[model samples]
Each structure stands twice: as structure tokens, then as C-alpha cells.
Target: MWTEGQDTCISLGVMVCVVLLTGMARVLVRRHTRSTFIRVFVAELLATFQLCCCSHELQVLNELRPDTPSWTLTVIYFLSLVHGLTLVGAVSNPCGVLEQLALEQMPVWLGFLKIFAQMFSSGLSRTFMVWVWSLGISSRHFAERSIKCASPIHIALPEAFLVEMLCSFIFHSTVMHFQEVRLKFRIHMQAALITFLVFAGGNLTGAIFNPALALSLHLQCFHELFYNYLIVYCLAPSLGIMLMVLMFIHFLPWLHNMNRIHKNE
Candidate 1:
């Protein structure tokens, strides 16, 4: 028989798979719905649920695994790779929707609706995770291990906020840069950068730069109006993404100018 930790990991893995596949199925089934919002909503909701499960499972495994430093980092890299490839609809990120809004590529009303759908779906997913944990602990023999929140132990709130802001800014800039790169490299680049940032700042801000997940998860830990959730998770990411877009806009011409100078010389 497997150890309790091992069993819990297996169960969590299964849960993540189920939720992610459900989301993907929504993408496939979109033809029947004929409603863009509904399809997007289902995909976002289920995909973010899968993300939460993966995050929680990572937490559980790091504690149970041998030489957590090595195993955890590897798992983080694998998860990031899976995330970039699977979540094709840009599920559960209000900041991504905001980026679209800033670019004037999406209608304001549609963006707001997407954000609302994301939040609602995240809440449902979080609730499902919590409920599963509660039932598993009480009803099962091998699923007795504990779940952990990403606690900012040593860092100050302001520092954590700054870390989140910088992380988000870098993330959005990378997204913009990736758009210009070939698709072959984009997913790997996404995995590498996402894993890097999570490894660097996960302890401080749960490494969750996604506002929808932040609102669903962290809001449960802190008070309703807590700065930790608002400033770091919500506001900082939006501001960071906005700034990234602005900087990209203002400097885009410099790239052509530099190329022209190089050719002339």
C-alpha cells in the first residue's frame, strides 16, 4: 500500500487532470453553444480550478518529497509548461483581459463581463477544492495530509507588493515579446519565465499574478479589503500590465531606429 502522502498526491493529480480535461472539452464543445461568452466562461472556470489544484498539489508534494528544493523546482517547471500549452483561452487572468482592453482590441463591456465570469468561476473552483479537502480528510484513510497556503513569512507587505508588481510587469512584457517571436519558442519561453518567477517570488505572493485566482484564494486568507489581496494581487498586476503596454508602445519605434542605424553602419 502507498503512504498517505503518496496517495494524496495521486488523488490531487487526478483531480487536476479531471478539471483541466473538462475545460478543454468546453473548448471543443463551443460549436454547440454558439455563445462566445458561455464557452469562454466554462473554459476559464474549469481551467482555473485545475490551476488551483495544481498549486495546492505542488504545496503538498514539496513537503512530502525528498530534497524538496530539487523536486519542487522540477514540478514547478512541468506545471508551467502544462499551463501554457493547455489554457488556450487565457483562462482566469483578468490582467490578460485588461491588456486586451488597454490595446483597444476588446470592448470594455465584454472585458468586464469576462472578469466577472472569471471571478465567479474561480470562487466555484476554490469552493470545490476546499470541499474535497474537507471530505477527504474526514472520509478517507490515506488522504490525511495537510494543505498549505503560500505564506509570506519574512517579507514585508510592501516588499511583497513590489515583487508582485515587478513580476507582473516582466510577465506582460514577455507576453508582448513572445507575440513577436515564433510560436515554436513561445510555449517554452513561457514555461521557463513562469517557473523562474514562481521560484523567485512564490513565497512572497503565492506566485499568483492572476487576479482571478488571487481574488478566489487569497481573499479567503485575508480580510475583504486587505491590501495584501488588493494591492499585491489585483492592483499591482493591473498597474504592471498597463505600464508594460505603455512602455512597449513608446519604445516600439526604437527597435526600427536601431535596426536602421545598424544597416546604415
Candidate 2:
């Protein structure tokens, strides 16, 4: 068995390598490409790939060291912050792309392209992480490689759906509200909110609020029906985003106008 220290070092090395390579790619793409579409595509793919690979590695660490909740939460917060800071001009989540589409901030074709890039990178990340595990740099990784895929949901389907939905709602709502906030503070707030949501709902549903992320981390698991994953992981988060858009973009403004009319009357 590999030592704990070795496992930690290997996991950190993998994450650092992912970030460095993807970061470099993004820089090169930005420097070389004048087309906004190509730049966005490359950014989305590389950013989502980096996010998924690090997340998958952390999930392995969580499984291998189940007792280390603090470590897991800390790492999640740090990586979320890093992602928020580095993923400029990239929507790494399909849900975010759809939200932009819903609000007319992005054109239909561009949204579709972004979603495609997110999903393709998500799947690619899964394969890459599996190969990393197969290398068996540590006993933890070796053991993780042989483990059968299992569903993350530990509650009833309805409850699991609600957990994911609520998590997504809160997260997207915060993102909307943070639009005017300065970038430095906004990144920290976003990261803190993600860490909090993960802590709150992690036990029940793994608190994954991104459809692309759920696809990467849970879609292949065997313990649940495929439809079940669709309901809780995919549909619920999308619904949450829809609700947020409706409230923020449509309902609230209409309500305010109605109230003002009543006051005038």
C-alpha cells in the first residue's frame, strides 16, 4: 500500500498538471486565434476538461480517505476559486450556457456550441482520469480504479431531485446577483457559496448542480436507472436555472412595474 503522503502528492501533482496544461492552451488559443467563436470553444473545452479532471481526482481522494471531510471541503473551495478566477470568457457548465441563451445574452448557435464543447470535454476528462487511476501512482488510485461505479444519490428520488434543484437555484441566483460585484470579491463569494452548497447537500446527492459535471461524474454509474440520473442530475438543475431566469428576468421586473402602477393609482 502506498503511504498517505504519497497519495496526497500524486493527487496534487495531477491537479497541478491539469491546470498548467489547460491554462497554457487557453493562453495560446487567445494569442493565436482572432475568431471569437474559436477562442470561446477552446476556452470552454479546456476549462471544462480541467474542472472535470480535478473534480474526479478529488472524488477519488474523498473515497480513499472518507474520514477527511475537512480536507475535501478545503480542496473544493480552493479549486472553485481557482476555476472562477481562471475561466474567463468560458462557460464551463452547460446550465450556464443555457441560462445565457434564455436571457438572450448568447445566440442559439453559440450556446449550442458551448454546450457541445462542455459535454465533449466532460467525457474526455472522465477517460483521462480513468487512465490516471490506471497508472496506480499510489495505492489509493489503484484501489479506486477497480471500484465499480455507483450512484451518488443516497436519498429517495424526489428528495435527491430537490437537493440538486435547490443547490442549483441558490448557486445560479448568486451568480446573477454577483454580476455587478468586482471580480476579485465575486470569485471568492462564488467559491464560498459552492463550498457551502457542497457541504450542505453533499451527503444526499453529492451536490452537483452542473449538468455537464453530473454527466462527467455520475452518468456512467450503475446502481441507478439511467432515467433516475436524468431526473435528479440533469433535469432538476436545468429546471432550477429556468426558474431563476424566470424570476430574475421576468417575474420580478413585472411585479415591480405592477406595484408602481398600483402606487400611482
Candidate 3:
């Protein structure tokens, strides 16, 4: 059995390798690809792959050291911040791509491509992680590989759906509202919000607000029915993003106009 320190180092090494390799791949793609579609596809694929690998590693580390909630929170926040800063020109979340489609900011075909890239990358990450664990570099990795699938959902299906929906709503709303904010500050705000959501909803549904991310981490688990995972993780988060977009585009302006008319009257 590896010591805790060795486990931590191995996890960190894995994350670092993923980040570096993704960065290199992205740079190569950008240099060689003139097609916008190809560039976007490569970007989305590498960014989402990096995200899923790091997130899965962190989750395994959390399980290994379950007693250190504060440590886990700190690491999550730091990783979120890193992702927000680094994922330039890439929409790693399928929900974000759908939101752009709804707003007509992205072509339908491009949005579909982005979503496909995200999902494909998610599956790749899952496979990659399984292979990494199979190497058994650390005792924790071996133990995690041997463990049977367990459901993250602890509540009823409806409640779990609501939890995921609320988390997605809050996250995307923040993203919408922070568009005018400076990048340095906006990324911090986003990271803080993600950290808070994960902390608050960690026990239920794994606080996964991204459909692609949920697919990568939980879709294959045997403890939950396929439909149940779809309802709570995939459908709910997408609906939440759509709801936020509708409110921002229509309801909020209508409410503001009504309030102004009442004041004028």
C-alpha cells in the first residue's frame, strides 16, 4: 500500500501530465488548422478531456482523504479557477453550447459539433482514467479501480433533478451576468461559485451541473438506472440553462419595463 503522501504526489503528477499534454495538443491544432470548425472541435475536445481527467482525479483523492473537507474545497476552487482561466475559445459544457444555440449566437451545426466534441472527450477521459488506474501507481488508484459502482444520488429522483437544475441555473446565471466583468475578476467569481455549489451539493448528485461532465463521471455507474441518471444529470441541467436564457432574454426585460411603467403612472 502506498503512503498518503505518495498517493497525493501521484495524483498531482497525473493532473499535471493531463494539463501539459492538452496544452500541447491545443497549440498544435491551432498552428496547423485553418478551419474554424476543426479548431473549435480540437479545442473543445482537449479542454473537456483535461477537465474530466483532473476532476476524476480530485474525486478519487477526496475519497482517499474523506476527512479533509476544507482541503477538498480548496483544491476544487483552485482547479475551477484554473479551468476558467485556461479554457479560452472552448465551451467544455454541452449546456453552454446549447445556450449559444438558443441565442442564435452559434450556428446549429457548429453547436452540435461542439457538443459531440465534448461528449467524445468525456468518454475518452473515462477510458484514459481507467487505464491510468489499472497501472496501480498508487494504492488509492488500485482500490478505486476495484470498487463497485455507487450512485451519487441520495434523494428521490425529482429532488435530485431539482438540485442539479438549481445548481446549473445559478452557475449559468452567474456566467451571463458576469459577461461585462473583467476576465481576471470574472474567473474568480465563477470559480468561487462552482466551489460553493460543489460544497453545498457534494453529497447529492455530485453537484455536477454539466451534462458532459456528468456523463463522464456517473453515466456508467450501475447503482442508478439509465433513465434516472439522464433525468437528474443530463436533462435537468440543460433545462436549467434554457430557463436561465429565457429569463435573461425575455422575462427580465419585461419585468423591468413593467416596473418602469408603474413608476411613470
Candidate 4:
């Protein structure tokens, strides 16, 4: 006869073991000079599996033991951060950082252009984030209105929002490093243009390009939680992307200066 607490403990233990093993695997895989696609695919698959397990376990625990305390929410917050960090770190293009550090080999104008492109990418990233959020909001609203034909549910849409923001930070920061490492054209003007188009397209399609947000929306649609598909898909990406851009812009100077010091030393 497994008690609720015992079951929860076992679940948590399994989650921890999975994470530790995944990290170890990542380290070992990184040491092997394998093909880029293989390494990336393996790393991303492992990381996603780890996060999915942890998130599923957490959601189950939250549901099974309703009326969670303050500390419980705090734990959820920490888990969310861990999930975001691991996911981004594992999948981020390894060469981006290397490119950013090699900016000294570039001309001043080229360096500025690189930074400018990053800013643009970061901005687009936020826009994409907001657009996803809007979609989630809109979908929920439309569904409820069509069914109940009344006002929208006044639910607080902050938890999923924060989770999405944290993930965006991890993603943009990792990409910024990759942009530095892999940038060849002095500026990612072409890539920037493509990103803009995709960002817009993602909004219209209701595909946030973010698994966590998608999960949150699913929870709402399936479990009677308040998830505004439109808001999630249309508005949240933009906000998240903008915030990331501001942080990266501030950090760009420090990154450049660090490279100079390293070279001199």
C-alpha cells in the first residue's frame, strides 16, 4: 500500500536520477568530436525528456495534492528555472559563443553590425514570445465565448507568463553567444529578415514555438484552466523578446571588453 507521500517521494527521486544522468551524458557526449547534428539531437532529446519528466511529475503532484502552500509554489518556480536553463543550454548552438568572442578579428563596423543584429534578433525573439501568449489567450477566450457566450474568465495569467519569460531569457542569451561564434556575414541581416517573417507567421499559426507555453495552453483547454490562446500566441512573445534584447544589449559591451582583456593577457 503506497501512501501519497511515499509515491510523491519516489517520483521525485526518479526525477533527480534522470537529471543527473542526463547531465553526465551531456558531458560525455560533448567530449566526443561527433557530427554537429548528432550531438545536438542527442543533447536536445535528453534535455527535453528530462524537463518533460520533471514538469509532468510536478504537475501531477500539484494536482494530486491540491491547496499547495507558499513553499510549494516556490519549489515550482525553482523547478521552472531549472527546466528552462537546462533546455536552453543543451540546445543552444555551441558555436555562437565562440563567434561572439572572435569579434576582434572583425572590423569595428562589422562588430557594431553584429551587435545590432543581435539586438534585432533579441527584439524579434520578444515579439515572438508575446505573439504566442496572445494566441493562447485568444483561443481560450474564443472557445469560452462560443460555448458559454458570456464574459471571459477572470483568471490570473501570470504563472505561465513568468515561465515563458524565463525560458526566453535562457534562449536569447544562449543564441546571443552563438551569434557571436557563428556569425560570418558581419551582420545577420538575412537571418534577421527571416526571423521577422517567421515571428509573424508563428503568431498567426498559434504555434508559440515554445513547448512550455503550449503545455500551459493545453492545461487550460483541457482542464478548465484560464488560458487565453490569442494572448499567448499573439502578444507574449513580443514582450519576452524585448526584455531579452535589453539585457543582451547591456551585456554586449562587457562581452567585448572581456575578449579584449583575454587577448591582451
- Distance from true location, Cα of 28 in model 4, Å: 5.3
What TM-score goes with each of the models?
Answer: 0.82, 0.95, 0.95, 0.43
Q: Give lDDT tens digits, candidate 3, residues 1-265.
A: 6789889888888988988898888778888889987898889999899999998899788877899988889988988888887797898999999888888998899999999999999999988998899888888776356246667899989999999999999998888888999999998999899999999998988899888888888755734478888888889999999899889988999999999999999
Give the poorly placed runs of model 2, Cα more than 4 Å off. Answer: 143-147, 222-224
Q: After aligning candidate 1 to the native by TM-score, how far in Å is the CA of 20 from where it should be?
A: 4.9
Least well predicted 10-residue stretch by lDDT in candidate 2: 141-150
The models' CA-based lDDT, in order, is 0.70, 0.87, 0.87, 0.45
Give per-residue lDDT, candidate 1, residue 70.
63
Alpha-carbon lDDT of model 2: 0.87
Could you tell me the TM-score of candidate 4?
A: 0.43
Clashing pairs in 3: none
* lDDT tens digits by residue: candidate 1, 1-265: 5575666566556556655676667657775788777776676666676776666555656656645666677777777777777777654688988988888988898888778878886777666656666655422322233233335424777887788889889988888777877665787888788888977887666677887777555544546447666777788888888888877875667787889999999
**lDDT tens per residue, model 4, 1-265:** 5466765665466467767876887788889848765564565456545654454444445544656544345445455455544555442221222233343343555434433333333333333333432443322212232122221223345544544344444545555556555434413432343234333332233223343334332433423434454344324544555566655665676788899999999
Clashes of 3: 0
Model 4, position 59, has a per-residue lDDT of 41
